[model samples]
Target chain A: MLKLIIENISKTFKDKQAVTGFSAELSEGVYALLGPNGAGKTTLMRMLADILKPTSGRILLDGKDISIMGDHYRDSLGYLPQEFGLYRNFTAVRFLSYFARLKGLDKQEATTRVDEVLKLVNLQQDRKRKLKTYSGGMKRRLGIALALLNDPKILIVDEPTAGLDPQERVRFRNLLSEIAGDRIVLLSTHIVSDIEYIAKEVLLMRQGTLIQRSTSEQLLDSVKDKVWKCTVEQHALPQLQKHYKVGNIQRVETGIEVRIVSDQQPLADAVNVTPTLEDVYLYFFNEEVIDGVQAGML
Target chain B: MYRQECYKIFSKKSIYLVFITIVLLLVYVHQLPTDMTMRESVFEELEETWGGPVTEEKVERARESMNAADAGEVSNHTFELRATDYVQFLVTGAAMQKQDQSERLTMLEAEMHDFDEGTYEHREAAIEHDMLQALDDVHGFYLIRSWREMFELIEPTTHVLLLSILIFLGLSPVFADEYTNRTTDLILATKHGKTKLVSAKLLASLSYIVIVFLSLQIINSFLNLLKFGGIAGWDAPIQGISSGLDSLSRLSYDGSPYNFDVWQFFLLTIALQLFASIAVGVIVLLLSFLTKNTMITFFVSSIIIATPALLQQLGTTDGFLGYLTDFSFLKLMQVSTLFTQFQAYNLFDYPVLYPYLLFILFAVVTGLLIMLTYRLFRNQQISH
Candidate 1:
């Protein structure tokens, strides 16, 4: 079954367009929403979670429009907002239990589910501690645990790994990859690396519109020859940066070395280099148009 | 859920501070010396300020000056004698003085000043009667003096502290904490987030209010009864009824007094205070939802509760606003006034009108507040 579908969705805040004529569909896998800050990735996810209503358009779950479903639609949906707010005075166990009850789990079921999710997030050891005493990563993990309380079929997490250290980030990614097998997980982030490994498909958003939607392999293939590397004199580096899209720069003992993305070779002794997800992100985001296509599409 | 909310209140340090403050106030009131001591002190001060008591030498000199009496002098003399002393003298003198001598003396006074009129006698008798009436008036003054002192000691400590603190503490945090912690998003996202959650908060606040109110009321009652000996029957002669009655007739009930059983008044005051406190609690909770800060909630509730009392203390000669203070909930909780034989006014006797009005107003305002909170939550954009 199609877990979620957002049809020609648009959201406006006052007079400003936040998300304009956005559309997407997801089913039983990890879907990454990639965007820069203020690109309306969070706004789109919020509409899908039913936390907000689109100014115009429909959000559906299994072919049923969720905007009209009210609380019944929300029962199977779990969301972790960009900033997760937990009561400082509540212990982790108490906090999760409260959310569980709110998710309509009965007492025994709430207790069991709280214990299960706490263990899943590796917070079982610290479950008795008050949230105020928790580290930032631990708090984030608790937020994820809360999102999983009802075993939701459609999980929406916004900037889920913004503050996690490397090890915790890898663990969180693994956790999501494990759970995404038979569920639809929409993960939104500005950090490219969080979704690079686990995401089944990536949706690139820029200026309130989805500019690109493709598999990770396809995104890299589109930018292959455009990326080139070269060794140059220290004085030649600044001019190279001004001319081409410089993806990375490093200083070598003999001189300055640089990576730049462009249609033609722009430097002497330049060699082709493999593009990264970060490079593709910048290419689409920085370029006004892709040849023969409208500026809105890639 | 309500039980958990109650636990939150009981465990809070602020609630303990309020509890301790109430207990200390009650203890302080309980330790006040008996009302007789207060009356005695007043009597001594009044005697010193307005020439000492009527002395025998003063009375004798006034009596000998007979019809040199400006008839005002006769009335003044009649106030100087003690009622007991004059009654004893009248009973004994009937046997000792000749009927003819007494008749001649009466006839001379009748000719001099129309003493043949009923309820009057010759110069000597009039002087004695004036002295007796004066004594009776002094006695009645002392009775009222004691009641007034007793009334003052209990009212402010028990009623004012209990009601205000309970309302303030119970409602101050209702919406402020949710906003401060940014948990309104999570709450509003739930199935019963809008209706059940708001209702739970209101119910929790009222539960705390009742607990605090009852605790203070029970403590105040126990302490008050411990300090003042139990006395019943509070209906007292209304003030301004003494002008037409004769001295002997007025003296019959003058020194006799009654008190509203303190327990009954205490319970009634508690009921009034509870209603008023809950009404204020609801209003303050609504304000908390709007303001979303505890400090603002505290200040706003304080002004709402204290404005009337402050106006009352400024006194009634200030006009209509002053008169309006009589209907204040703060003023109505003063049950001790019901024990006084004479009140400055009948303001406290009327059943509390404002508390009922406020109760309805609170309900309407809280209903509106819940609706607003629900709407805000439902449409809330979760911010990082």
Candidate 2:
């Protein structure tokens, strides 16, 4: 059976469309929800989580509508909000225990669960320390611990590593990879690299619409020959940005080195380069596609 | 649930300060002398009675001789005749015997008249006797005390505070906090985080309120008894029905009238003060929910609670405006006025109408505020 299905979901705020006609189905493994700022990625994820009711469309988990399932659906779902809040005074253990109770575990069971999750997040030593005393990375780990307290079948984490240090981010990425095998793990992030290693599939969103859904390999393949690098004068950078979708620009000792996506080489010295997931992301999110390359390829 | 909330309140430093301050204030009040003279000009009276030069050796000797004769150790005629002869001898020199005698007689007569028939002396004696009786009555109350009676005394104030704090703090983060903290996206993304968690929070907050309130009331009552002695009488002396005397005369044993028994009035005053405090708490909670900031909630609640007293004070002399004071929750805190009898021109004019009317009005307003708060919470959008 499909673990989760979202059908034509849309959400609007005041006069602005946040998420529109978004649909997806997942059975298992890691799915990366990649988008730029204000791309309705978070909105679509929220609707599937049942935290937000969609203006139109239905979300079904195991063939049961989540809106009707209510708390029962939530019982099997683990969620980490983008800006997760904590009761600053609470110790990490105490905080996890509270969430465990809310997730319907009794005292003895909650204690065992909290201890297990604290170990899973590698926060066993810091469990007795208050959240206010924790570093940003530590707090993020605690948020993960709380989300995993119920042993949820489907885990949803939004910008899970936004504030983590390089070492901690790598550790978190590895941890997510280890857990993604048996259950569906939906990861939403603006950072392409957070998901590049673990995500089996990538879903791109732009301006409240699903721009693309494909394997990480397929997304990279689509942008393979389209991305090109060229060295240009400092004064010519702005002109290049206007003419083409500039993915990256680095100021060298001599002038500026630029990475741009185009179907054909636009400059004499330009050379085709291997494309990363970021190249595909930049192509869809940034305006202006090359003449021969279809925008749908994004 | 209640135990958990109690633990939270007990953990807070602010609640500890409130408890300590109230206990200290109660103890300080209790230490005040119960036999205090109420007259404003007590010092002047003392000055007028004792401001004179000391008597000389001759006058002292004469007074001593007369005192001895009055005790019947010697013949009064012999002592009086000798005293007169000695006074006459002194009168020829520096002594003012006649003036001294007149002053002595006036002082004695005044002392006798005051002790025999004055209201202060009578009331003082009555209070001394009543206190002893009250100690006995305390034991009786303990034997027959019921949960219903205790609840009746406590529930109103407790409910007010509970409802007030819950409504205020519960609404604090509903919209304003989320917008300020920029956590709307994260919260909305969780499976049922927006809907389930918000509801859980509201439940937790309200539970905290009920626990805090009940604790405060229980602590207040215990402390009140410890400081002021135990409850023995449910009906205040002022509330008693008496016949064959005017309202003014019933308040006095002698011709001079006073407010009421200070101890009884003090107890009633504390109860009323608590009521007002709870009312202020409730109003503040409503404002907090509406404004969604601690600062706005504090300021708005203060203004709403204080406005009644301000209007009463400013408009008291304006006749029609005086009636407005009767409706104020602030006036309820002035327990002294509630126990005092107001004068009227005729039998048709009754003074009990004001407090009775005000009490009902406050109760109704409190109910309405709670209803409004519940509606606000229920209708609020769970998800951003």
Residue lDDT tens for model 1, B39-64: 22333343332222233443444344
Badly placed stretches (over 4 Å) of model 1 are A286-298, B34-162, B229-268, B308-384
Give candidate 2 regions above 4 Å deviation.
Answer: A231-239, A248-257, A288-298, B1-11, B32-286, B316-379, B382-384
What DockQ does model 2 achieve? 0.17
Candidate 2 residue lDDT tens string, B1-384: 223223333444554565555446534543444321111233223223221222455446555655665687656355335434333232222234234334444554555456644344433434333333332111100111111123212233333333344334433333445445443444443443435544454444455445544555566556445433445333322222121111111221111012233345444555654555455445555565577676576566545545666675566435555555555554654433443432111113222234455666677886777667666643344344
Indicate the DockQ of the complex predicted as candidate 1.
0.28
DockQ leader:
1
Could you report the DockQ of all the candidates, in the order they appear? 0.28, 0.17
lDDT of 1 by residue, A67-157 (tens): 6777777787778888757777789998888777677788899999999999988999999998889998999999889888889888889
